[model samples]
Target: MTVNYEKLRRRFYLRLDAVFSVEELNKLRFEYLSSKSGLVRGALAALIQQGVEAEQLSMWTGLLKECNLALARRLEFIRERESNEKLTAEAVDVSYPARPFKVGLKHPLVRVIEDTRKILTSLGLEHVDGPEVEDEYHVFDALNTPAHHPSRQMQDSFYLSEVGKLLRTHTSSVQIRAMEEREPPFYIFSLGKVYRNDWDATHTPMFHQVEVLCVDVDINMSHMRYCVGFFLENLFGCAKMRMRPSYFPFTEPSAEIDIRRQDGKWLEVMGCGMVHPNVLQNVGISPDKYRGFAFGAGLERLAVLRYDIHDLRSLYSNDLRWKVS
Candidate 1:
């Protein structure tokens, strides 16, 4: 049987011209070049099996081989064309202006806490932290806070659903935790958030505090006063400060330190005194063997004074307009 090589070549080129996709090209390849039923390959095999003359066989084989090469070259051309179309469709324009991005500043309270931490840490005190969710034993009872103290009440404090558990009212609890974990003669300071049931221009339900503690033999009020004074001078610029007698459950002879502002008005800033013997004893330290001093200041209060922020609530209002140093 004679093969019509001219007709086969024409049919292949006709199919190739109509192929608009890689999928259609693949189907055309399978129809003409596959070994099982391919028109070109099967016809060549049939001519050989029928014992055709050597010259005729050579002509048919050569035609089939040329058809295979033509299909391969067409496949490469189609692939290159599709790739260029995709690149054109997905091209990005570099000439357009970049989108505007808004950057943010740190909150005033955080700045105050970080500044205070650096100052206290420079004064030979190590930084420590504790959990925000705490038990009554650490937050109040271990600090020598009396059972009837106003801070233990739900109206003044936040109590969790679990009995005797509450969100700490101050970072003073961190000091209690530090004392319980280590035998002190240790100097440390802590900074973190505290919760209370109050909110106003000067007060917020949640605020930050930095508390410092020093425990060793003969750690007197003078040491406490000097440390507080140095911190205030460095923070607020050498203002005349006075210590007014105040009371706290954890400190004996507690005084609220006040600094004379530039306007000649005294603003109360922090509370400090020698650690109460009961507080030392509660933490398993003997009062006779060691005495210490502790001080705590609200970050919001100091930030307000430093930045001249009018309202404490503004620090938490998420208002981007209020800028601070």
Candidate 2:
């Protein structure tokens, strides 16, 4: 059987010229150029069986090459045109507004912590840290907290199975650790999470606290008073603050510090007082030679008061609509 190379070439170009879409061109290319079942391949196979002359075989090869080149060129042209059309249809106008995108913000609690750290650190206090999971010694006994204290009760605190290990109820434990590691005439602050068996709008099982300790010669309540007032003034911008006598196992004369709100109501913000002689003695510091003051504040409470947030629980809600500013 004689293969009509001229007829095949004419058929290929006729179909190629009629191809209007990339899909149609691809189909046409496969029909004529496929190695396994294409018209060109079948015709070549037939020539192999029929023993076509070398001259005729060379001619068939040249025709096949021309057809393949033409198909590729057509495909490239169609693809380029399609790309341009898509770009034109989807072009953006320079005068149009951009689509809005959301960005994350720092949480209110974190803001309060940083602000407090900045103010206290400026007062010569070095920042320190301690473990959230602490032993009974540092968390309680070393801090002069008696065994019968309410905070030692399981209902008020979280205790572990290790007999003496438990979640720290306050950053005060860090102060004890610092005092044991350093000598007097030093100032340090600890900021991190503390846990208690507590849950309410203003209280969570886990919350952030910043505890400051300054142990130096002649350090008294007056120095503490000035430091506390300076911190509150810088933090809240000229807010009314008052200190009233209170009680804490770690301090000789404990006082609860309060800040007045816009509504003229006083809200307790933190607790402070002179370091107890027992507490200093437990840390191997001489109470007779040196006295200091320590204070602890809740990060969440400070944020709530500063931002005028009504419910403290909302700080932890993680709702996107909740404005930290």
Candidate 3:
């Protein structure tokens, strides 16, 4: 039942010397020093349990305790060396040129919508939101679109049911809804995706539009003209605005807004006019007391003009190449 002290110490040193990592050192330490089945610990316990002479037990115990401290110090040294080697291996050079990384950019359409909102907001216009699938009353009746308006026709609209609920064709519906909720002596703007059964090089079934409505006692066509001019100047840095006689069911003197391109081409950008009495009355606002203006412009048209994109469909393709270009 006597412990072989010399043999146990030699075997422990052999195991410790083979450890080259902190994890390996930890395993080695546990094998020899753990209380239950540890080689050194078990040997010491066996010597005491088997009733060794006091002097012999004291000498052996003292020697083993010294060896245990030496083992621990050695393990600590190994741990430090392992850590230093890892640090050296993984060190980064601060002066070295960094690897290039790709960064995502905002979509051109999003940029257009954000810029449009920013410009109108700066002009004291409040931005508002409404539902995409809208009621017929808000989408048409509230906006003074007569029952026969081209936009409401089966060929143009995406009617959901016979009850007259469908995807809004323009942000104008949002403006109408906003007016109904509050009495206005204020300017409001709404921007979001609208839908219709239309598509071509210059059109899409789903597209974005920014709608503006200004309601006040003295709101006039001159105020709307200045607004159109101001918005174009700030948005596209466009100059040379031209307004012509146009018609909308909701406006008294509707004009299709056009901006003069550098190529001397007059590009129609938006529609604006004095709010009609009927549209005002439909929203419970008196026409004589609250005359104002409303304008709506396609965000895709702005993106096309701003980025000089040749095809309107490119904006909706979600193709990285088109966006990057």
Candidate 4:
């Protein structure tokens, strides 16, 4: 048996009117009539014609007019709601708090540096700094990395001028500068921004480095080992550490220090060794008379390893969501 489309449409309208209050029915009817679809228009027209044929023309005409008016009012209500929401959202301010703003605390990176500085100072190391932009001599040659060394390749160093004066590649250069200007039997710590030509999830073109160097007459490899081990234990709050033989131009018997991760794996944290005789000699210190230990590491690497940060870029990205004290 075939169903009559006109009968179905008329029945739908009557059922809607029976189930809904007059106001609700009128609102729904307005939506149906105002719709531009041919199907909706046809359905409405058929319902009206059915109502006329059924001798309810006056009732049907009143309902249709009410539906149309209700639709106009509903549209205005929606427009007003939208305008209010837009205005409220526009007026909202999400910026960092203004000045006299109790000025929020330091960035996580800075906090870590400050804390480390304090820890080192408590251990009798004096804090020092050097220029970010440095000459080739202090950055490379004075550190026992001669001009012919492969580590000075353009791919590794950021040469800033046609003459090759560039950003210091490591904080160790600061150690060199300090030794040149200060008398030793002193403990020194340096932390500051360093630059390289590398960028990746684990590396940035600019980042921070911290180094600790201690020089005196009686200091030896044992002192170097003990100092590094003590610092690592204090910094990480762990006593387990391992050192692997490593290579660095400025340090003799250089070794990379590794700490045990929570996951039972070891990760290299920093490189350290007894300062090479040549490096000391270049800085005008007699290696035979003065021996010291130098250790350096990327600050971000320590943060990443300690805090389980997966991306080095996040530290510098200024993402408020990730910022923490």
Considering every candidate listed, which one attains the maximal TM-score? Answer: 2
Q: Where does model 4 exceed 4 Å of error? A: 1-106
Prediction 4 TM-score vs. true: 0.68
Give the RMSD in angstroms, all C-alphas superposed, for model 2.
Answer: 8.1
lDDT for 278 in candidate 3 is 90
- The C-alpha local distance difference test score for the whole of candidate 1 amounts to 0.88
Q: Considering TM-score, which of the candidate structures 2 and 3 is the better prediction for this target?
A: 2
Worst 10 residues of 4 by lDDT: 1-10
At residue 201, candidate 1 shows an lDDT of 97
lDDT of 3 by residue, 1-325 (tens): 2346777767777777777766877777678778897776777687788887887677667756876787778778887887898999999999999999877778988888888988998998888999999889988888778887788898998989658789988888887888789987978999899998978999999998888899999888889888889999988886698998999888888889888999988999999899889988988899878899988899999899988999999887879875465
Worst 10-residue lDDT window for candidate 3 reads 1-10
**Candidate 3 vs candidate 4: which has greater TM-score?**
3
- For model 2, the run of ten residues with the poorest summed lDDT: 316-325
lDDT of candidate model 2 versus the reference: 0.88
Query: Order the candidates by lDDT, highest first — what do you get?
Result: 2, 1, 3, 4
